[model samples]
Target chain A: GAGVSQTPSNKVTEKGKYVELRCDPISGHTALYWYRQSLGQGPEFLIYFQGTGAADDSGLPNDRFFAVRPEGSVSTLKIQRTERGDSAVYLCASSPDRVNEQFFGPGTRLTVL
Target chain B: AQSVTQLDSHVSVSEGTPVLLRCNYSSSYSPSLFWYVQHPNKGLQLLLKYTSAATLVKGINGFEAEFKKSETSFHLTKPSAHMSDAAEYFCVVRLERGGNQFYFGTGTSLTVIP
Candidate 1:
């Protein structure tokens, strides 16, 4: 892809439901990141991946949240037992390398009812 | 650990007027500073960055920022504000020697009056 791309730009799900958000990074990028943004707040780091391995998952809020980049390209963020507080924009970004500048996607607005 | 503080939540300026948005950062080591802008319903756009190259860094749309180590500030400035400049701005800080993570400030909203 020319830029980072996210699927399902808007997602509406009920509480306790499971949801999966996808991210397609630019071609040949080796680093991917996920973030969450609440209203009136800046994006908060969720997780980071280097190639197919998760280098930093410390930012994941809890056990309910998990992300995987199976082939060092596309990534998926899985949320289990979603709660209303999970309503926010989920953003994805990618960089050529772990230390380079990141390019962001349009983001998916997740709304949990 | 690194954090950014955007001093002003909102700032308004008339067209052709000078613009200023204040930001302060805290980091354990020398920091990589950045400014990103977000238009309504859009992704973030990097405005400028200070990666220890020069204290005065210029960016797109005639915007620029000066990194002041003594003041611990990286303030965005524009000599002439345009209506198109109205948007939300964020200040970000990254640790020079860390896990390559970036910390962002809450953000500052800029209103340009015609």
Candidate 2:
């Protein structure tokens, strides 16, 4: 079975540029989540989607960060005017339901210069 | 608000020795607790979870955690450490009322010495 996967294992972009990271959750999993992990830190929640709607997005750091899951299986995280502080590993995870255990995907490491 | 606290930032142990990683959680209700491990350059893997089932929960890789409601703690432990057990471990908590929001601890780096 294919596990949750994220494209562009690594990405480097200049500050003030825009970047998009994609995530494909596990088959049949209805809950998708995004988290950011800085060096020596645990993953911090960013956003979560249940089915086609965003169930919660309070963890998004600022207005520049946004995410969408239009089709309910794939998700995209968009960042505008990227800052060097945004350099970190962006992890995606999915679960069968809201209270179920989540399975994580290999994160996309974004390096903003 | 729900939160988790990992007492140790780093713990070192030799092979065949007992391993203990302390974690304490604070929640307004009976929370769902979990332990996750991440190797270098790999995604986080769920070690185990406790969701109002038994006080003692067993997870993969011979790991286990005991949920103490009175103490508000869910600490991970292993009888004997292995070199492969060296990784970053995180304690997570999920609130009962929140919108399935999971909170993570700072993480503890386990270093296994042979």
Candidate 3:
């Protein structure tokens, strides 16, 4: 079975531009999560989805960052007016249940210039 | 607040030698602890997890970790180090009451010299 996957393995964009990163969770996974890994640091929680609705989004840095998981399978992390500070590896993960271990994706490296 | 702390930023060992990666966690409630390995340009792979079951947990590639409530630690260990084990390792903690958000440690880079 195919594991979780992220599209556009690498993306370089100018600052202040809008960027969207997509994630495809494993089949039958009901809980999805998004994380950002800065250079030399660990991944920080971004947002989480249970089914089609976001159950927790407190990890989102600011209002410019938003995510949606329509249909409960595919998710997209949208960054408006991207900043250079936003440059990092965007990782997505999914689990069968909320308390289970999550399987992670290869991640999309977004670089804001 | 639930958080993890990896004691070392980097560790190097010779092949066939023992490997140890230390991690300590802080949480208000009984937490779920996990160890994940990340190779270059690859996704994070689960090494093992401790969910209040048996204290000694074994995982893939001959890796294991012991959850110690007394020490507040869940350190990863292996009897023999393999060259293929070189990578970044992360320790994670998740509280039972929270909304399934995982708190991660900075990470420890392991290097195996053949």
lDDT of 3: 0.96
- In TM-score terms, candidate 3 sits at 0.98
Model 1 residue B62 lDDT?
99
Q: How would you class the docking of model 3?
A: high
- By the lDDT metric, which is better: model 1 or model 2? 2
lDDT of 1 by residue, B1-101 (tens): 34899999999999999999999998768888889999999999889999888899999999999999999999999999999999999998877654667
Off by over 4 Å in 1: none
- Candidate 3's C-alpha runs over 4 A off are none
Q: Where does model 2 exceed 4 Å of error?
A: none
Query: Where is model 1 chain A poorest over a 10-residue stretch in terms of lDDT?
Result: A95-104
What pairs collide in candidate 3? none
Reported per model, the fraction of native interface contacts reproduced equals 0.42, 0.89, 0.89
Error of 2 at B67 (Å): 0.2
Shift of residue B49 alpha carbon in model 2, Å: 0.4
**Which lDDT tens digits does candidate 3 get at residues A1-113?**
99999999999999999999999999999999999999999999999999999999999999999999989999999999999999999999999999989999999999999
Q: Write the per-residue lDDT of candidate 3 for residues B60-106, one digit (tens) a residue.
A: 99999999998999999999999999999999999776587899999
lDDT tens digits by residue: candidate 1, A1-113: 38889999999999999999999999999999999999999989899899999988878999999999988899999999999999999999998986667888999999999
| Model 1 TM | 0.97
